[model samples]
Target: MKAIYLESINAPFVLIEKEKPTAGPGEAVVQVKAAALNHRDVYIQYGRYFTKEYPAILGSDGAGIVTEVGAGVAPDWVSKEVVLDPSTDWGDNPGVHSKEYKVLGMPQEGTFAEYVKVPATNLHEKPAHLSFEQAAALPLAGVTAWRTLFTKCALQPGEKVLITGIGGGVALAALQFAVALGAQVWVTSSSEEKIEKAKALGATGGINYKTENWGKALKADVGGIDVSIDGAAGEGFVQLVKVANPAGRIGMYGGTTGMIGQINPAEIFWKQLNIYGSTMGTNQDFAAMMAFVREKKVTPVVDSTFRLEETEHAMRYMEAGKQFGKIVLRVG
Candidate 1:
C-alpha cells in the first residue's frame, strides 16, 4: 500500500510504499478510494495539534470499498461501499464526548493511504447521491456542520442563519444544510469572490468582513439573524453578536482567528442570547448527518481534486485558505 508519511512536525510528507493494514477485532480494512483534507491535517503538520507522534499517516475524511472484516464483525460488511466516520471512541454521553474520544489521523493511522483500518461502527453507507470524492468530503465537515446547526443550535426552517468565513468546508456545508432546510442563509467572507460563490450556492447575501463596521452593515442590511455559526472567534465574533436577534443562538466550532478581544456582556445578557461550543460530533451525530445528506440529496462542494501522491500539494492549498470547498485526494 502507498501512503504519505509525515516524518515529523514541520517535515514534508514523504510518499512511500508500506504494508497494507489488516482489520483487527471489531474493525474493517477499507480499500480507500478517496480522501479529503481538513484544517486538522494542516495543523498536525505544523505541530499545532495536541499529539506529537511522528511518522504518521494524516487524513480523517475518506470513502471506499470494504475489503475485509475482522473477527466478531459482520461478514456482510465486505464488498460494501462506506464512508469513514473518523470520530473514534465517542463514549455514551450525548451532550459531550468522554475523555476517551479522539479524532482519526493523529495517534492513529489515517486514510491517506491505499488501505486503512477503522472500527466497523464508524462506517456509514455511502450516500447514493455522491461520488467517491464527494463522499470523502462529507464526513468531517458535514458532521461538524450538522452538530452545529441541528444539535447545538436547533436551527429551524424559515429562520435567518449566518455562517462566517464562508469559503471553508464546514461553513459551506452549513450553508448547504441550512438552505436545504428552508432557512434563509447569509455569509461573511473577506473575499468578495468567495461571498459571490456562496450566494450562488443559495446564500441570500454576504458581507466582506474586511470593511470597517461590517457587523453594523449586516445588522443594517439583513435586519437580525436568528442563528450565527462562526468558526473565526477573533474580533469579528463581536460582529456576529451585533447582528444576532434577541435570543439568537451562536454556535462556535473553531477559533481560527485566535482569541476574541472583547464582547459586550450586556449584548448577551440583555438579548438573552445563547452561545454553544461544538467540535467534530458524536457517533449519533454522524449517523443523523449522513441520513440528512442522503435524504436531502446534498452534494458537498468540491473545490478541487488531487492524486493520492499529491497529498502535500493538497495540504498546502488548504493551508493557504484559498479553497472555497473541500480539497480531495484520489486514493484508489
Candidate 2:
C-alpha cells in the first residue's frame, strides 16, 4: 500500500510503501478512492494543531469502498461505498477515547493512503449524488459549516450574514448553505479575484478586505449583518464586532489569522451580541448535512484535485492560501 507519511513536524510528507492494515474488531478496512485536504492538515503538519506521533498519516476526510468487516460488524456493510466520519467515540467508557469522543486523524492514523481501517460506526452512506471526489470533500468542512450555521448560529431566512475569508473550504460551504437557507450573504476575502469567486457561489456581496475596511463597508453598504461567520480569528474579529447587528452572533471556527483576536467589551455589552464557537459536528449533524446535499443538490466547491502521490503539492497550495475551496486527492 502506498501512503503519505509525515516524518517530522514542518517537513514535507513522503510517499512510502507500507503493509495494508487489517480490520480489527468492530472496524472495517476501506480501499480509499479519494481524500480531501483542509487547513487543519497544514496546522497539524506544522505542529500548530494536533500533536503527532512519528510517521502519521494526515488526511481526515475521505470516501472509499468497504473491503473487509471485522468481528461484530454487519455483513451487508462489506462491499458498500462509504465516507469516513473522522469523529469517533468509545462506548460509555472513558479511557483512550471518551464516553462520547475522539477524532480520527488527530491522535490516530488517518486516510492519506490506499487503505484505512476505522470503526464501522465511523462509516456513513455516501450521498448517491456525489462522485468519490465530491463525497471526499464533504465529511469535515461540510459538517463544520452545518454545525456553525444551523446548530451554533441558527441562521434564519432573509437575515444578513457576514462571512470572513471567502476562498477556504469551510467558508465556501457556509456561503452556499446560508444562501440555501434564504439568507442574504456578505463575504470578505483578501483578494478581489477570490471575492468574485464567492459571488459565483451565491454570496450577495463581497468585500475585498485588502482594499476596503470590511467592517466599515458592511456598516455603510450592507447596513450591518445579523450574523458573522468568522473562521479567521485575527484582527478581523474586531471587524466582526463592528459589523454585527444588535443581538447578532459571531460563529468562530479556525484561527487562520494566527489564533488570537481582540474583542471590545463595551460594544459586546452595548449590542448584547453572542459569540459562538463551533468545531466539527456530531454524527447526526453529518447525516442531516448529507440529506441537505442530496436533496438540495448543493455541491462542494473543489478548487483543485491531485493524484494520491502528489499530496505534497496539494499541501503547498493550501499553505500558500491560494485555493478558493477544497483541494482533493484522487486516491486508489
Candidate 3:
C-alpha cells in the first residue's frame, strides 16, 4: 500500500510503500477511493493540534469500498461503498462527549493511503447522489455543521441565519444546510468573489468583513439575524454579537483567528442570547447528516482534487486560505 507518512511535526509528508493493514476485530479495511483535507489536518501538520504520535497518516475524511471485514464483523460489509465517521468513542452523552472521544487521524493512522482500517460501526453507505470525492468531503465538515445548526442551535425554517468566514468547508456546509432548511442565509468573507460564490450556492446575501462597520452594515441592511454560526472568533466576533436578534442563538466550532477580545457582557445577558460551543459530532449526528445530505441531494463543494502523492500541494492550497470548498485527494 502507498501512504503519505508524516515523520514528525512540521516534517514534509513522504509518500512511501508500506505493508497493507488487515482488519482487526470489529474493524474493516477500506480501499480508499478519495480523501479530503480539513483545517485540522493543517493544524496537525504544523503541530498545533492533537497528535500524540509521529510517522502517522494524516486524514480524517474518506470515502471508499470495504474490501475486508474483521472477525466479529458482518461479512456483508465487504464490497460495499462506504464513508467513514471519523468521530470515535463518542460515549453515551448526547450533549457532550466523554474523555475517551477522539477523531481519526493523529494518533491513529488515517485515510491518506491506499488502504486504511476503521471500525465497522464507523462506516455508513455513501450517499448515492455523491461521487467518491464528494462523499469524502462530507464526513468531518458536514457532521460538524449538522450538529452545530440542528443539534446545538436548533435552527428553524424562515429564520435569518448568518455564517461567518464562508469559504471554509464547515462554514460552507452550514450555509448549504441552513439554506436547504429554508433559512434566509447570509455570510461574511474577506473575498468579495467568495461571497458572490456563496450567494450562487443559495445564500441570501453576503458582506466583505474588510469593510468598515460591516457588522453594523449587516444589522442595517439584512436586519438582526436570528442565528449565527461562527468559526473565526477573533476581532470579528463582536460583529456577530452586534447583528444577533434578541434571544438569538450562536454556535461556535473553531477559533481560527485566535482568542476573542473585548466583548460586552451586557449584550449577552440583556439580549438573552444563547451561545454554544461545538466540535466534531457523535455517530448519531453523522447518520443524521448523511440522511439530510441524501434527502436534500446536497453536493459538497469541492474546490480542487489532487492525486494521492500530491499531499504537500493540497496542504499548501488549504493553508493559503484560498479554497472556496473542500480540497480532495484522489487516493485509489
Candidate 4:
C-alpha cells in the first residue's frame, strides 16, 4: 500500500510504500477511492494545529469501499461503498464533544492511503447521488456546516442567512444547505469572482469585505440576517453581529483570523442575539448531515482533483487559498 507520509513538521508529504492496514476488532479497512483536503492538513505542515504528530497520515474526509471487516462487525459491511464520519468517541453529550473525541486524521491513521482502517461505526452508506470524489469532499466540511446551521442555529425556512468566506468548502456547504432548506442566502468575500460564483449557487447577493463599511452595506442591502455562519472570527465577526436581525443566531466554527477582539455586549443583550461556537460535529450530527445530503441531493463543489502522488502540490494549492471549493485527492 502507498500512503502520503508527513515525516515531520514543515516537511513534505511524500508518497511512500507501506504494508496495507488490517482491520482491528469492530473496525473495517476501506480501500480509499478518493479523499479531500482540509486546512487541518495544511496546518500540520506548519505545526499550527492544537494537536500534532510526526510520520503521520493526514486526511479527514474520504469515500471508499470496505474490503475487510474485523470480528464483531456485520458481514454486510464488507464491499459496501461508504463515506466515513471523521468524528469519533463523541460521547453521550450532543451539545458538545467529550475529551475522548478525535478527528480521523490525527493520532490515528486516516484516509490518505490506498487502505485505511476505521471503526465500523464511522461508516455510513455513501449517498447514491455522489461520485467517490464528491463523497470524499463531504465529511468534515459538510458536518461542520450542518452543525453550524441546523444544530447550533436551528435555521428556518424563508429566513436570511449570511455565510462569510464563500469560496471555502465549509462556507460553500453552508450556502448550499441553507438554500436547500429554503433560506435566502448572502455571502461575504474579498474575491469578486468568488462572490459571483456564490450568487450562482443560490446566494441572493454578496459584498466585497474589502469595501469600507461592507458590513453595514450588506445589512442595508439584505435587511436583517436571521442566521450567520462564519469560520473566520476575526475583526469581521463583529460585523456579522452588526448585520443580524434581533434574536438572530450566529454560529462560529473556526478562528482562522484569530481573536474575537472586542464585541459590544450591549448589542448582543439588546437584540437578544445568540452566539454559538461550533466544530466538526457529533455522531448524531453526522447522521443528520448524511441524511440531509441524501434527501436534498446535495452535491459538493469540487474545485479540483489531484492524484495521491501529487498530495504535496495539492496541499500547496489549498494553502494558496485560490480554490473555490474542496480539492480532492484521487486514490487507488
Give the residue spans of candidate 1 off by over 4 A. none
Model 2 weakest 10-residue run by lDDT = 90-99
lDDT of each: 0.93, 0.85, 0.93, 0.94
Each model's RMSD to truth, in Å?
Answer: 0.9, 2.7, 0.9, 0.9
CA displacement after TM-score superposition, residue 60 of candidate 2 (Å): 0.1
Sorted by lDDT (best first), the order is 4, 1, 3, 2
Give the TM-score (vs. native) of candidate 1. 0.98
lDDT for 58 (candidate 1): 88
**TM-scores vs. true structure, each candidate:** 0.98, 0.93, 0.98, 0.98
Tell how far residue 163 is off in model 1, in angstroms: 0.3
* Candidate that would win on lDDT: 4
Q: Summarize candidate 3's per-residue lDDT along 197-269 as a digit string, tens digits.
A: 9999999999998988788999999879999999999988898888899999999999988989688999999
lDDT of 1 by residue, 1-332 (tens): 89999998899887999999889999999999999999999888999997788879989999999999999999999999999999988789889988888888888899999999999999899987899999999999999999999999999999999999998999999999999999999999889999999989999999989999888888899899999999999989988888999999999999999999699899999999999999999999999999989889999999999998888888888888889999999997
Better-scoring candidate (lDDT), 1 or 4: 4
lDDT of 2 at 164: 89
Q: Count the backbone clashes (under 3 Å) in each candidate.
A: 0, 0, 0, 0
Task: Tell me how far candidate 4 lies from the true structure as C-alpha RMSD in angstroms.
Answer: 0.9
* Candidate 2 deviant stretches above 4 angstroms: 90-100, 259-262
Q: Clash pairs of candidate 4?
A: none
Scored by lDDT, model 2 comes in at 0.85
How high is the lDDT of residue 249 in model 3? 95
